[model samples]
Target chain A: MNPAVPTWAGVAASAALVLLAVAVAWHGRLRLARDIAIAATRAGVQLAAVGAVLLLVFQHTGLVGASGWLALMVLVAGQVAARRARGLPRALPIATAAIAAGAAATLGALLALGVIAAQARVVIPVGGMVVSGAMQATALVLIRLRDEARTARPAIEARLSLGLPATDAFAPYLRTTLRTALIPAVDSTKTVGLISLPGAMTGLILAGVDPFTAIRYQIVVMYMLLAAAALASLTAGRLAEHALFDDAHRLRPLTTEPRRERV
Target chain B: MAPDELFALDQVTVRRGRAVLLDEVTCRLSAGVCTALMGPSGAGKSTLLRLLNRLEEPTAGQVRLHGRPLADGDVLALRRRVGLVGQQPVLLTDHVPDELRVGRPDLAEGQARTLLEQVGLPAAMLTRQTAGLSGGEAQRLCLARALAVGPEVLLLDEPTSALDAASAKAVEQTVRRLVAAGLTVILASHNIAQARRIADEVLVLRAGRPVAHGAAADIDYLKEES
Candidate 1:
C-alpha cells in the first residue's frame, strides 16, 4: 500500500478510524470527544496542506528553497518553545537560536558524513525530526530552569551573598536542568528497537524499503536526535543562566506569566 | 561623610508595588559598630539589613558605604567586602566544607577549620555532610561560610532565633569578637535581650519605619510619639 498518496478507499478507512477513536472516547465518558475530533481534523488539514507544499518544493528542489524551509521550521519551533518560558529575558530569540543551532549541527554532520543526502526531500524530513527533538529538549530545559530558580532561591542566594559570581552560583542548577532535559531523549534511544520499531524504520519498511537498510537509517536518526537534544539543552541552559541574573550579581525576580492556549 | 561612619542610609525608601517595605529611613552606623535591628515580623528588619550589601536596593534613596554610594562602587567587590547570613540556614552544597568554599574554591582545610571554630562548630564538622546538621549547627556553618569571604561588614537576619542557649551565646560572642576586631555587623533579631547583649547600637523598626535608634542599653527607652 502506498502510504504517501492514499486512495479514496484508504482515505475512507482512515476517516473511519478517527470516528472509532471519537466513539471510544464518548463511550468511556473521557470528555475528549470534541478534543479528539478537533485534533484529527487539524491533523488532516495540516498534513494535506504540507503534502501539497512538499510536492511543489520537491519539484523545484534547490539549496536556497530547502534552506528557507528549514529556517521556517526552526522559527516556528522556537516560538513554541519560547512560550514554555515566556517570562524569561529574550525567550523567543534564545529558543529559536538554540533549536536552530542544534538542528543545523546535527544535519550538517549527517550530510557531510554521507549518512543523509542534501536534497530537499531527504533534508526536510530528517531536518524536521532533528528540529522537533531540539525544540522539545530546549522547551523542557527552559521550563525546568525557571522552576528550579524559584524553588532553589534560598540556596542560590546563599551562594550569591558569599561573593560567588552569578555564573558559579547558578552552575549546579544549570547542570541539573540539562540532565532533566536530556534524559527522555537518552531513554528513548536506549529502548528504541527493544520497545518497538521506531517511526522512521516502520514507515520505511511499510513503504517497501529493505528492513535491514531501514534499521540502518533509523539508527542514524536516533544518534542525530541525541546529539541535537544535548546541543539544544546546553545552548538554552547557558543562555537562560545568564538571563536569570542581574548586573548587580543578584537573581532577578521572575514574574509569573499567563499560560497561553495553542491549537 | 563622618570619619567614623561605615554605612549611611540617606532618605531611603523601598516600595513593592503599593506596599512600603522601607519608608524614608535615614541613619548612620560607625565602623566596628554592632547594630541590632529589632522589631516584630513584617517590621522591615530584614529589608534594612539587606541594604548594607545591596541584596535589595531601595527604590528611592541612597545607601553609602565608606562615604561612597553603593551605586558607584564595583558591586562585586562591594559584595565581597560586605557579606550576608540569612535567617534560614541555607547550605548550597551537600557537605559542610563545600558550602564555606563557595567563592573561595582554594580554601584549605586549616582555613575551614578556623572558620568553623570561630563559629563555635567543631573542626570535625568541616568533613561532615550538611544534611546531618541540626538547626544550630547549620546556622553556625552559615556564619563560617560568610566569614570565609573575609567580609568587612556582615548582615545577619534573625541569626540566633533558631539556636539553643549555648549556641546562641557562642554566635553572639563571635559577633562581638568580630566587631571588636573592627568589622561592622548589622543583625536583625526579635530577641530584645540578645540585642542588649551584643549590639552597641540598636535600630528598632515598626512597620518599615525606624522608630528608635540609640544605645543597646536604652532598648526599653522607646516611647511611641503620635
Candidate 2:
C-alpha cells in the first residue's frame, strides 16, 4: 500500500470518522458538535492551502524563498499569539521576536552541527514545527502572566508597598508562568513514543523512511521543541512582566478593555 | 506648610475617566500625630490615603513629603518610609516571620519578635503558619510586617474594620502606642468612635471633598454630616 499520495476517497473516509465523533458529541448534549465540525472544516481548508504553498516552495524555491516562507509563518503565528494576549502591551512585537529567535536558534544549531541538511524540503517543515511550538509557549506565557497580574493584584501590591523591587515582587508569578508554559512540551517529550506516536515519526515512517532513521529524527525534533519552548516562554514572560508595572514600580491597573490601538 | 507637617496634599484631584474619585483636596498631616480620615464608602477616603504613598497618582496638583514633591525621589525609598496596611491583610508567605521578612530580609528574629509584641501578637506566633491564624491575628501580623520596615509614616485604610471589638481595641491601643513613640499615622475608618479614640486630628470627607478638618474632639460636624 503506497502511503505517499492520499486520494479523495481517503479524505472522504476521514470526514465520515469526524461525522461519527460529531454524532456522539450531539448525543451527549455537549453542544460542541457544531464547533467540532467548523473547526475540522477550517483545519482541512487551511492545511490544504499550506500544502499547496509548501509544494511550490519545495519544487522551485531556493534558500531565500524558503526563508521567506518561514518568516511568513512566524508572522502569522505571532499575530495569533498576540490576539490571544489581547490586553497586554506590545504583544505582537514581543511574540514575533521571541518565536523567531527561538526557531532560528534551534534550526541554526541543527544545521551547524550537520545533523540536518539545509534543503528546502528538510528546513521548511522542521522550521514550521519549531515556530509553532514556540508560538504556543509564547501565547501560554503571556496569557498566564496577564492572569497572574490580575488575580494576584493585592499580593503583588503588598510586596511593592513593602519596598520590594518590581522584579522581586513579580518573581513568584514569573516562575509559575514559565513552569506552566513549559509543562506541555516537557510532558509530550516524555510520552512521545510510549503513549502516542508523534507526528514527525509517524509521517516519516509512512513516507517509507527506515524506522530507526525516523525515530532519530523524532528525538531531534523533540529536543528542539523543548529548547525552543523554554526560550520563547522565558523571553515572552520577561517582556510581559514590564507591562504589569508602571515607571513608579506600582502595579499598573490591569487594562481590562481590549487594546485596539497598536503602539 | 507648617514646620512640623509631614505630608501635604495641595489642591489634589484624582479622576478616573468621567468619575472623580477625589476632588480638590488640600490638607496638612502633622508629624507624630494620628490623623483619622472619616467618610462614607464612596467619599474617596482610601483614594486619599493612596495618594500619600503614591499608590495612586493625582491627576492634578501635587503631594509633598517634607517640603518636596512625593514624585521627586526614588519611589521605592519613599514607599519604604511610608508604609501602607491595606483593608484586608494579605501575607505573601506561609510563616508569620517570613511574611515580616519580605523586604527586610536582614531582620533579626528578636526584632521580628518585638514587632509581633508591638502589634499585640504573642512573640511565639512568629514561627506559626500565617494561614493558620484567625482574621484578627492575621491583621495584627500585617501590622507587624508594616512595622518591620521601621517606617516613619504609616497609612492604614480601615485596618480594624474587619476585626471584632476586642481585636479592634487591641489594634487601636497599638496605634496609640506607636503614635506615642513618634510614629506619624494616617488612618481611614467608618467608625467615628474609633476615630475619636485614637486620632489627634480628624479630616472628614464627603463625596471626595474635605468637609471638615479640626482637632479630633472638635469634629462634631461629622455626626450631622454623615
For model 1, the stretches where C-alpha displacement exceeds 4 angstroms are A1-6, A112-114, A257-263, B17-19, B162-170, B219-226
* Best model per DockQ: 2
TM-score between candidate 1 and the true structure: 0.91
All candidates' lDDT scores? 0.87, 0.89
Q: Candidate 2 clashing pairs? A: none
Q: Which segments of candidate 2 are over 4 A away from where they belong?
A: A22-38, A257-263
* Share of native interface contacts recovered by each model: 0.67, 0.67
Write model 2 residue lDDT over A75-194, tens digit each, in one string. 999998888888777889989988998888899999999988899989998999999999999999988887788889889888888888889999999998999999999999999999
Best by lDDT, which number?
2
Worst 10 residues of 2 chain B by lDDT: B217-226
Model 1 chain A is weakest, by summed lDDT over 10 consecutive residues, at: A254-263
Compute the lDDT for candidate 1.
Answer: 0.87
